[model samples]
Target: MLKLYDNEKIVLIIHKHWFVMARTIATFAALVFIPPVILTFLPLATEQFDIRIVEPATNFFLSLYIMVLFIFLFLLWMDYYLDMWIITTSRIIDAEQHGLFNREISEIPLQHVQDVTIEIKGFIETFLKFGRIRIQTAGEREFTINFVPHLYEAKEVIIKYAHEAQKTQLPVTSN
Candidate 1:
């Protein structure tokens, strides 16, 4: 399993479905792209193309294409691998990859969360079991961070955790 976030008291792990979606998308993309790649080589393998056009540079271009293709695949995997949404006993975190070289991690305390909303739109989303969750905070920000895919379930978990955090908090009074 992927160890996303852990602390002394609690750990928030990514749902297994998240990794399943990532792997499924990656496999589907590979299936779609591989055929064209094979077709590109098919003519050469069968000697259908004339030798004049099949210069040594053809191999170079093919290698370059393959390189680019793998690079894209690697990036896709890395994006999914790095993307993480976590809620611990104390806080909520959103970690995302800006690119191959850049990453951003944002976090807010569970005590800051005031409300949570789950939105399920479209027939397909309802059927496929994926939606979005928006969390509202007591802070200056008017909107809560949004989480997609397992919105309803995620909201439930987050709210549960936040409320648990609240139970332990001392009431505050403004002076």
Candidate 2:
């Protein structure tokens, strides 16, 4: 469960573009079929070698290959599913998962946000409406989210709440 500050509400939970996940699946699917396709030429191999040993060895190796591929596919799915950004009324929470054990989370308060920039490049990115959003903060540091779908809408939400958060900043104290 996500812990929130008092009176804070979540505005958005953003994931990588659906196309990214789709492409991952497509690539893995193609890889998964490679062993079977190669096995279709099994008779040629059997003619050169003993059928019993070669067939079982091929089955064993192919099974291992497929098992390894599925594990990799699961890892990709975990990376896709776990890497996310949470936009709240008070802050933007960037949580990126790298592999199984490594994760990094950063928070940028909307009040400190200096700018939000959007970049959409290439025909695919432009047509698919997926791109990158870079957040510039008052501290001069930047945080970037890539393969972000609906980037324009995300920018608007961040800008809108950033303006609101800026309005609520503590007033300057007189010396």
Candidate 3:
């Protein structure tokens, strides 16, 4: 029987770009709704409307508009937050967004991983699920994969791979 190197319990990706969920919400608020709200109240913008003639009806419509905007913003955030990629010792895969397009998938072998680093910065980042993972290999120079949650744990996973590459001749946890 072919033995797997890291079993699901021993090694796996716990989460994805989880921070993007919050950021996606904030982005929708800032990008979609805020602009329209500002335009609605602006003197030059709203001046085209006859507020005196359409007061009560306008108020109802305006409230509805705000409600719709909030819903759209929430949905937009949910989509972004949900987009994620994960890997375990058993397999590698990608979760991605393509406009309104939903999840996309991709994968590679653990043997491809060369170096890994976990970077945590800023006060909010330290408190939140925000940080980076850099993976280096002989095949590609590109590194600095961003917005990975629980960066330290991801680094540990990579370190585990390094141990396997060396046939676990040396302790991986040591500096």
Q: Model 3 misses residue 107 by how many Å?
A: 1.7
The CA-based lDDT of model 3 is what? 0.59
| Pairs of residues clashing in candidate 1 | 135-144
- Which segments of candidate 1 are over 4 A away from where they belong? 1-10, 15-56, 140-147, 170-175
lDDT of each: 0.65, 0.90, 0.59
> Which structure among the candidates has the greatest lDDT?
2
Q: Is candidate 2 or candidate 3 better by lDDT?
A: 2
Q: Write the per-residue lDDT of candidate 3 for residues 1-175, one digit (tens) a residue.
A: 1233433323554344656566666665565555456546665656777877556666677687778878877676656655554555533444555557555654444556667777777887788867877766558853555677777777777667655644634322211
Total clashes for model 1: 1
lDDT of 2 by residue, 1-175 (tens): 4788776889999999999999989999889889878899887767979888998999999999989988999999999999999999888999999998899998888999999999999999999999999999999999999999989899999999999989998432223
Q: Which tens-of-lDDT digit does each residue in 26-104 have in candidate 1?
A: 7756766765777677666958767677655566676787777677777776776677776777777777776678888
> Sorted by TM-score, highest first, which candidate order results?
2, 1, 3
- Models 1 onward score TM values of 0.68, 0.89, 0.60
Top candidate on TM-score is: 2
